[model samples]
Target chain A: MPEIRVVNFSKHFGKVRAVDNVSFDVKDGEFVALLGPSGCGKTTTLLTLAGIYKPTSGEIYFDDQLMNNVPPKYRNISMVFQNYALYPHMTVFENIAFPLKAKKMSKEEIEKKVLEVTKKLMIDKLLDRKPMQISGGQQQRVALARALVKEPAVLLFDEPLSNLDAKLRMMMRAEIKKLQSDLGITSVYVTHDQAEAMTMASRIAVFSMGKLVQYGTPDEIYNEPKNMFVAAFIGNPPMNFMENFKVQSKDGELFATRGDIMVKLPPKAKEVKFEKTEGLVLGFRPEHCKIAKKEVENSIPANVYVLEPLGRDLIVNLKVKGVGGESELIKIFAEPGMNFEIEEKVYIIPDPEKLHLFDPETEETIL
Target chain B: MAELRLNFFQRNSSKISQAVMIIILVLITSPILLGYAWLILRSFSVDMVHGFIPTKLTLKNWRFLWQEMKGYPNIWRTFLNTFWIALWVMILEALITSMGGYALSRYDFPGRTSMLRFILVLHAFPSISLMVAIYYVLKVIGLLDNLWGIILLKASLEIPWGTWVMKGFYDGIPWELEWAGLVDGYGRFEVWRKIVIPLVKPGIAVTAIFAFLSGWSEFVFINTFIFSQNAWTLSKYVKGIIGDFRFADYGLLTAVGLFYVIPTIVFFFFVNKYMIKLTIGGVKG
Candidate 1:
């Protein structure tokens, strides 16, 4: 296994910056994923790491050795492309044996390793079948097996599970995570799918518009986002933001207010020194916003706009009357048994400890 | 009943249009087909000097050709010369075009776009226009009347078009396959040989067939450059019979033409699938 460190790497396709001064480190045996939307440069970063595209600037190091000038073949890496890219002319056995053959291993040894990998992937029965003859899931397994059979220093995946169907993608995600853990090989997977990154990666590097937005553990990224972008990006339904919120200290008590809908600020808010801006954006996840029957001390009155049942939970969209002229809509996760009619008046009390406050101008978290 | 009658009439009119289309196709194709058939028939007729519709039929022409082969070795010499030239051209064309095409498809070198544009522009220049210049150049280089001269000229002439065709075929193959091979410890050339070349076999086959035919049937260059009878190709040999007014052996000429077409017909039969694949996958797709 090799520890890969990308140091100030940047790739420019003409004027378009595909990867912009991105740097990260993958510890030996670590499974890291580069996650972002399409055109967010995650795949480009992975391709650069694989040495498919030479960086426009900066250096990459494998362990202590500089690798910017090294060719891909000399880098001792294996890559599984998004399309699987199995040789259409070769059978599964041949595809898996290709790397070993390239290394000039004995035929008997190649066959033994091929059989071992195919068995581990449960694709031994498909050894003789071409890529087109196999199912998508089987093809994915073959791709993984081919990459693993080489026993390279680092394994790179470019959205390897993006082409599979949803159910199969889930299964393969778990399988890939398990495989990485079992082999203890350094792997870097690139995907636009947040759930895939959350489920499969030991650490996720979130990218946006060719910039590394955040790099942290899934739990840290989800629960304690550093910026408004991370807060909006990490959650499935996304976080709701209310602008022009003010924090005031009145009668030795802390309260955050937007018009008349004011709630007592958590103890942590007192520690933050607010800037001169009058408007602060209050952020809360859908799950943290609770629906209550009666107005409590910190509850805000809202009218239910739409009720969406999501099997075990309900997403209730509520429009709250604001201090400003217009009303703002927010989603609250309700219990499965809870039922509310459209346009019905209700009150919502956000969990203060879970509330995220951001500077409206910069969109960076205030606390 | 009236509606059903109208529907039947429409269906019959459609069938008649289809027949008319087939008749038009035949009308366009029959001249070439009939010409080939007449040549084959005349080759075997005893009185082919008059016309292809000979009153008497015999294998006199065939027997005379066989007799001449034994004494002069003309037929064998010409056949060997043409085959040798075509073989060299085929090998050179496939190797040069495949490598050039692969480079053009994969690499991002300086001046690549201008080079590709230059090649495309070169393709637009008719080969006939270059015949005189090529002949003079070959003579200056002491290659006149030499088999290698013709082979070299033919292979060079075929490269631009062949490279264009194969480059398009290479473009259709995903770069990821080569990338996978590269990351798996194969160098660029090894990736091309083991991954890229195998994927574009149909393109190479197409280039080979076209190159072979171009070299095989070329008359203007072969007839102009070759002065000696020994260095004469099949086309030059065939032209000789047509040139002599005193003994214009039409039957022998026809027989030789038929013999020459046999290889081409066999070649097309084997590579027709690849040709279709090239047009379908390389061009339209």
Candidate 2:
């Protein structure tokens, strides 16, 4: 295993920059994910790492060797595409043996390595079946088998689970994570699914547009996002953002105020140096807010709009009156057995420690 | 089955249209069917008592099958020449177009779109208009009156269309497959040979069929440039039988024409599925 370093790498397609200047490092045996939405350049970064695309600027290094001018075959990397990309004309055995054959390895060696990898992936019985003859999940496992049989220095995956059904995707996610740990191969995974990144990656580099927005561990990215984009993109229900706020200190406690709504900042905010205070935005997760029947300190008044029951948790959709001259919708996760009625007035009290403040102009985290 | 389907007019109108369609189809196809019947009958009959009716049956008209016709070279020699030309043209066109189409489909370069459009325009210019220029070029190369000259010319003329059809097939393949090959440790050319070419087999089949048929039936180029009698193909041989309209042997002409077309029919039957796939591919693509 070798450490992979991408320094100020950029890839441009004609006049359009598919991947802007970005830098990151993957320590030996580390599983790093480039996470972003569509057209966010996550896949472009992975392809360039695989030597499929040349970087417009900057350098990539495997350990201490420069890989800028290396062709794909010489780069010693294997990729699993989103579509599996198994050769339709080839059986599973041949597809897995392709990389070995390319190296001119002896027939016996190719067969042994292919069988070992296929058995490991639990797709050995399908060795004689063409790609189309198997189910999508089986095809996926075969693709993984082919990629692993090469035993390359680095493994790149471009949303390998995106084509699978949700239940199968969850299963494969665990399988891939376990395999990476067992093999200890340095890997780069690209995905637009935030949960996939948060659950599987040792570290994640979040991308937006064509630039690397933030790089951190899953815990850091979820608990302390660097910017508003990272905060909004990482969560499932998404972080609720309320703009047009005025942050002011009252009785030595920081409070964010909008029209008739006010929220108390967390106690830890006292240590954060505020660059600006007038124009700020308040952010909090739905799970972080609790519904109260009566008004409480640092709570906003709202009327119940709708309720959605999800087995264990109930999502209460509330409408705050006159937050910014229009009723604003808010959501809070409550116990499924709780009694709630439409148009019933309530108060939304957020956990003080989980509150976030951002500057409106830069959209960067302030506290 | 449900019986409460349609109103009276709807059912009656459908029946009327079906009847009308049958009549129209019968009217349109009967002439072609009768013409083919007469061609087969004329090839086997020696004399006709009533108009368009065979009166005597004989195999003399098909003597070209066993011996050369008067004033013509051995029939087998001409057949072999045609076979060689067709085989060579099929090989050349398929080889050139498959490679050319892959290039047009995959590579990105300056004027790529313009070049594709230019190919279409080149194909649009009827080959008949370029006969003079082709003749001069063949003369300059000292290949005039040669079978190879006609083979090369026929392959070149069919290339633009063959290349375009092949390009369509190549475009349907996912780019991810090639990327996977490259990442799996194959160079560009190796990936093309091993991965891409196998996938475009139907496209090559379609191109080869058209090229072979064109070369087998070639007469204008051979007649104009190929002055030597030994180089004549089946198409030229058939033309020679009908050269003297007043005293032409219609029976021998029909027999030779049928012989020339039997291989084409057999070849079509062998690869009929590929032609159907091409149509479906065109529609889907």
Candidate 3:
């Protein structure tokens, strides 16, 4: 396996910059994911890495060998498309054997290799079945078998589980992650699903609007996101933002204050220098906010708007008055047994140690 | 109840609509059905009364099947000529249009839009209006009265439509399949031949059918360009037998006309499924 290095890569379609000056590296035998929403340059970066699109500028290297001008066929990279892309006319065996046949492998070798991969993927019984005759999950396995049979230098996946049902997607996600690690092939997976990226990738590269916003491990991305985009994009129920809070120092202790709501800064946040005290946004994850029957230290009073029962946990949506004199809704996960009637007044406090502060102008994390 | 009476028609609406559909279909198809019946009857009978009554049954009208008529080549000679031209046009049109359509659909080059627009304009112009120019071109190329010339002319005329239809089918194939092939280490042409072509078999079948049927039934081009009796196709030969419309053998004309149409009818039956699917696919797409 070869380590993949991309240096200041950019791609433009006419005037639209699909991927802009993004740079990252995939260590040999490591599984990395390019994650973002639609048209966020994740797919574009993957295609460029696969040699489907030439870089508009900068260079790509596979262990110090420049790959900017290489064609896809010569790149020795295999991709599993989101649709699976198994040839509808060909049987599963034939589909798996396509790359081998292209390499001019002998018939016996091709059959042996195809059978071995199919057996591993648990699709040996489906060898004679065409793509249309098989189920979507079966087709997915066939596509994986095709990509694996050749033992490519790099295995690329383009949202390969997006076509499967929710249950099957989770199943395939675990299967693919295990398979990639077992084979120890350098791989780059592209996806918009945050759960898949968090569970499967050794490290995740989050993109937004054609720029690489943050590249870190799943825990790092979730717990210490570098910016507001990564913080919002990487979490479920998403990160909540209380915007336009002014930082004030009272008796040498900093507090983020907006209208009647005030929050004391934790000891860890005191070390960071704040260039602009005003227009700072306070960010916190839904799970980090605590609901209280009575006011606690640094707690903001809120009205219980609604309660969403989700099995073991309940999501409590609270309405609070903002600095602009408008009602803002914030959600926090509470125990399912907890109950609150609509329009009931309560106090919600954010975990001081886990709270995030961002500069509204730059959208970058200050703490 | 009064509501029950109102709901009665609504409940039986499906059955009523089915009955209405059958009646409409029969009414629309009865004239063509009667014409076909008359053609078959006239070809096998010696005479007829009131256009339906046959005076005598005989095999004389169909004698041209084995016997040579004056001023006409053998029936087999004309049939073979027509068959060869139609076959060539079918093959040539399918080949050229499939390749052209693939290029127009896949590749982005300068003048691609202009070329597509030009093809639409070419198809829009009636071939009849260009007969004078086509005649002079054929004469200049020394291919007048040649079956090859007619075959070339018919195939070229059908190309715009064939190319357009094939492009639509090609457009329906996902780009990821080609990308997979490329990533699988196959050259672009190899991917096209092994993957893309097989997927568009229905498009090729529809194009070939249209080309063959048009070439088989072509009259104006063959009548004006092909002058020799040896090179006469079934269409021109049938026209020759009806010269001046005086003293024409109505029975033989019917026999020959029915004979000329038999292959078309047979071919239609053989590929009817593709034709139906093509219409639905075209409309839905």
Candidate 4:
């Protein structure tokens, strides 16, 4: 059963539409990430799910029960804020036990539950310490314990690891994933970090300019992006885009050409009708481009502009011929020990199966 | 000899700077301190006609004040009345301002921005401009010559400024802490009580001190609205001693002023730590 469903949710703030016509469902135990840059409405969407925000126009359901008018407390959800938001004056024990006390639980039961959560989070030693007395990482753990102690139906996290140092962030990410899996609770995590979203989410919903551009498993998002924005936003070095060339039919065989780079059309590419005067964008991931010693059938000769050594791999920036505009610059990842100097000419052959075509006007993928 | 010369050069410059600072400090504070001492000496002088500076010191003026003048009970009544009015005003001001400030700091409501602007304008208005209207209004309400009237007036006048100070303090408290309480299953009221109020205690102390000092030393409203001898406050009673030129009692008046100032000085000393805490907390939070 779907634990939470947002139906055509749209929230506007004055002249700005923060979340525009967003809709998604969370399965009973699935972990989903609303990933986007700041002001892309990821946090707004999480807040709406937490019931901190009432949608401008939409309906929400939790396990077949409508939650449109429900206040945050009655929604049976717990949220961890970006700042961790541990009560500064309260000891860890009190911070975790507060939710139980609110529910009128017996003092013994509250203590027991608080102790259990503290033990699980490995913060039992710091249970009596105030938040100010503990380190930030410890405080974050206490915040997580406080949220988990309630055993709510859903968990919402708003950039919970953004405040931690890189090493602690990685550690906490693993811990959060393990805890979510163990509890089997539906969770919606919000983060602007693409690496975090890719690593943590069962499926990711990529947002851009207050709209969900794509929602799928990480593999689909990385391999089969639906639009130019998603293709650029999801990858680290980003997909390199070059203008398309006009196709010429000779003896009923189609050939696409741009400068020295020309190739016969693949069976899949030949079936699509290329619109005249409608420009196309060709894209390929950096990792898919390779340096070949021999001239391959569809390889292009390019000059190496810059070489960046990333310890484990080399990022080779190439200047492709006749690609036009700033996108003539293409990135290629080479294995370590592949040495290249500036102005050195090389051959870059992109994998045919990995090539992506987009209609430049609409910015949508062609195939 | 060389080491001695170096020590002399370092020590001489520091000694001169220290001497200059001490001189400036004495120049600023000595007038008030010395005048107060002279008043004490004059109050105990044996001969009033010769003046207190050259005359033998005695308790004659004190005796005259206790036995001959009808002003003694008025002074005592005024002191008690001032104490009650200031005490009640301080309590009322602190409670109303802290709660209102907390709400304004932590909640979003309709007209919140306009309401804040209006309160700021009220705080900026000169209190003296309202004096005549306030007097006539008090007369119509029959609050003139009433003790509760003075308490209510002082509290109402102090609330806007006190609330402004408290609101700034509450604004400095991170909203995350309160939201944490809310997610921990506390309602809004519980969050205010358990988190917001405890965090702003130093602010409450600072606001209380301002309210208390203002109410304690207020003169114009208390004098205008209160005409009854039994309801007079300390400042009003002190003013009465100097009202008539024929029976002016400078020595007695100075002694009473010293008595009134002592409590404020003592109260300030007690809360000095809280004031420092308030400043540091404001910066950190």
TM-score (all chains, Cα) for each model: 0.93, 0.96, 0.97, 0.90
Off by over 4 Å in 1: A320-329, B1-6, B9-21, B46-53, B69-73, B244-247, B283-285
Give a tens-digit lDDT track for model 2, residues B57-143: 989899998975678777888899999999999999999999999999999978999989999998999888998999899999999
DockQ of every candidate: 0.58, 0.69, 0.66, 0.57
Off by over 4 Å in 2: A322-324, B1-26, B282-285
Q: Per-residue CA lDDT of candidate 2, range A291-355, in tens?
A: 88988888989899998888788889888775446877777897556799899999999998999
Which digits, one per residue and each the tens of the lDDT, describe model 4 over residues A36-91? 98999999888878776789998889988988777777777788989887777678
Q: Give the winner by lDDT: 1 or 3.
A: 3
Question: Would you give me the overall lDDT of model 1?
Answer: 0.86
Where does model 4 exceed 4 Å of error?
A244-256, A263-267, A270-278, A293-295, A321-327, B1-69, B74-76, B106-110, B277-283
Winner of 2 and 3 under lDDT: 3
Task: Compute the DockQ of candidate 4.
Answer: 0.57
Model 3: per-residue Cα lDDT at residue A3: 99
| Model 1 TM-score, all chains together | 0.93
Best by DockQ: 2
**Leading candidate by TM-score:** 3
List clash counts for every candidate, in order: 1, 0, 0, 1
In model 2, which residue pairs have backbone atoms overlapping below 3 Å? none
Q: Write the per-residue lDDT of candidate 1 for residues B147-243, one digit (tens) a residue.
A: 9998998888889989988899899888788888888888888888888888889899989988888888888888778888888888887787777
Clashing pairs in 3: none
Per-residue lDDT over A213-294 for candidate 1, one digit per residue giving the tens place of the 0 to 100 score = 8899999888888889888888778898887878888787678886677877788877888884368888999988778877
